[model samples]
Target: MAFPILATLVVLIALATLVPLSRRTTWLVRDLDFPRLQIAAVALAVLVAQLSLLDLRDYETVILLAITLACLAYQAWWIIPYTRVFPNEVKAAVSGDRDERLRILTANVLAPNHNAEGLLALIREHRPDIFVTLESDAWRQRHLDTLEDEYCHAMKCPLDNLYGMHVYSKLPLEDTAIQFLVEDDIPSMHAMIVLESGRKVRMHFLHPAPPSPTEHEESTERDAELLVVARSVADLDTPVVVAGDLNDVAWSTTTRLFRKISGLLDPRIGRGMFNTFHAGIPLFRWPLDHLFHSKHFTLAHIQRLPAFGSDHFPMLVELAYDRRHGATQEGLEADAEDEALADEKIAAEPVSEADVHEPQA
Candidate 1:
């Protein structure tokens, strides 16, 4: 009993602190940073579980194993919008007056994946009015044009590399604009969209690359881009919808801060963790794709799509905000320590004087 509980704590601690200890890796799987850490965490956990079987029928050992599994669940699914230990990231309080009811889908079609026909088929089948794609190329641009009639309003920033981005929509776009908010060549799209019901939402689409020595060197720029957006949403007078690959899990400190800052509702809460990445492999799959909305909009449906030649499986969300009660909130969910930590995280993000510019007209 004591041994298993003790071992479980050790494993949870490892998972929690893996990022800070292993500065070399940020992502846990694929050819990325978190791969080794995730593997080690799982391997160590399995060893702990097997070691406990030494005393079969031991109720305490069984209980400890269950508890250990529970901890793993919490780490992966729950702990995000409420981290308390690390307060070094930027955070802003959620604010807004009206909820914008609209449905949107964001996906990252790996540039190298040639079988994009399936993805297009899925898009046509689901028929989301608003679609955002990351890691796109020219071939993708031509193939995706099939929706040009359906989505008359569109923005395309195609590149030969993985940074290509595109946004297509049927909604009336106001102030539709694209900018490289952080790094040049890597673009993000932001625009005002009005739904058929007269509801207007400030939609921001982001797909910033994650932090690793080989990537952007550190999360400074990533944190800054998110903080800038978070602050923008926090200051908004209307409901907002920000979505994309994010490159970070929906439950990461940064994402949580974005939710808190934007006052958005994660449909996944109380719902299952919809792992979106690693569709090519089973053992390494997790939810990297996400959809979050203002409280006014209720989730009509949210699901992970089948693989379409990309490592990430796209997510589709149907939202309706014509609620009887208006927008409800999750409240100021973070503690002062974590809140301050978030403040620091945002503050410490690297910002250049040239980075600040007036929003494009």
Candidate 2:
């Protein structure tokens, strides 16, 4: 009885290992990408228990061992890029003109959370040049309005839906627009920010819906919106920065493709995971809030801030634009096949607002 039960468990774990590798955008398959680390850990534990307790007399036991080992290797391949073992894509910010520096703070305030004081305190201490909030409804916007004195330039879309986003900046904003790329209600911010040195940097802030039971059942819409944005930034010859709660993990296939298509560099790569979501549960966290930038900038500072009663912890990053370094930095390149994949997602009909459900305020 024990052997049969354990074999069934092993088979289920092995099946889960293949889900994330599939290119399908179904929720179950895409959600598998979030727990690669946890899955690997569990696989290792199961392998040890099986070797010690189960007899290796049967071919079935040997096959189980082989499958577990293969799963661990596959997961490690996907995760290795985010660890220190890999080389950093964005170089460290070196001594240069300090006026070109841009500090950004992005947080998903978890709309229902009322702990604005804690987030406000962090903003007062850091005083980032640009501040962005995700899942921001009218209530969260009212609480965040206190910082308007310091951040005079503001753009906000206060909706009851969790997709609401707002941006507050101390720098001058030029040619700003609130675009609804895929869905009408889901808004994204697009603008150019003038630095202290009079140089303009293009910036975009987005918070797409995640694949979940209550909201989106599949990742098609999320993938489409991101790929569309990625295409716009792919070859732009200016300093650019994209940040917000992307609602996706750093290691997912879609994210990897986005990095390739946009030619953006991830500061977190080879630095740290900087996992921001699931702040209440240490065991179920992944990197959801992201800050990706063009090669024109070098990283000065990047760190995950403490949780302030939201489901996501805030991310603070400081970057400096240097044209000399930009010429030398290399970005991921997408081949013909990559382009085709992106086009397919973009062409798919966008998920309607009616298909989504708003969380109760």
Candidate with the greatest lDDT versus the true structure = 2
User: RMSD in Å for candidate 2, one decimal?
Assistant: 4.8
Count of clashes in candidate 1: 18
Per-model TM-score on C-alpha atoms: 0.76, 0.93
For model 2, how does the per-residue alpha-carbon lDDT over 84-168 read when each residue is reduced to its tens digit?
A: 9888888898947778999999999988889989999999999899999988888888888988888999999998888889999
Q: On residues 210-305, what C-alpha lDDT tens digit does candidate 1 reach at each position?
A: 775568656656766776676666544566677888777655556666676656667766555577888878777656776665655556667787
The TM-score, computed over Cα atoms with residue i paired to residue i, of candidate 1 is 0.76
Which stretches in model 2 have alpha-carbon errors above 4 Å? 56-58, 350-361
Q: Using alpha carbons, what is the TM-score of model 2? A: 0.93
Ten residues in a row with the worst lDDT in model 1?
88-97
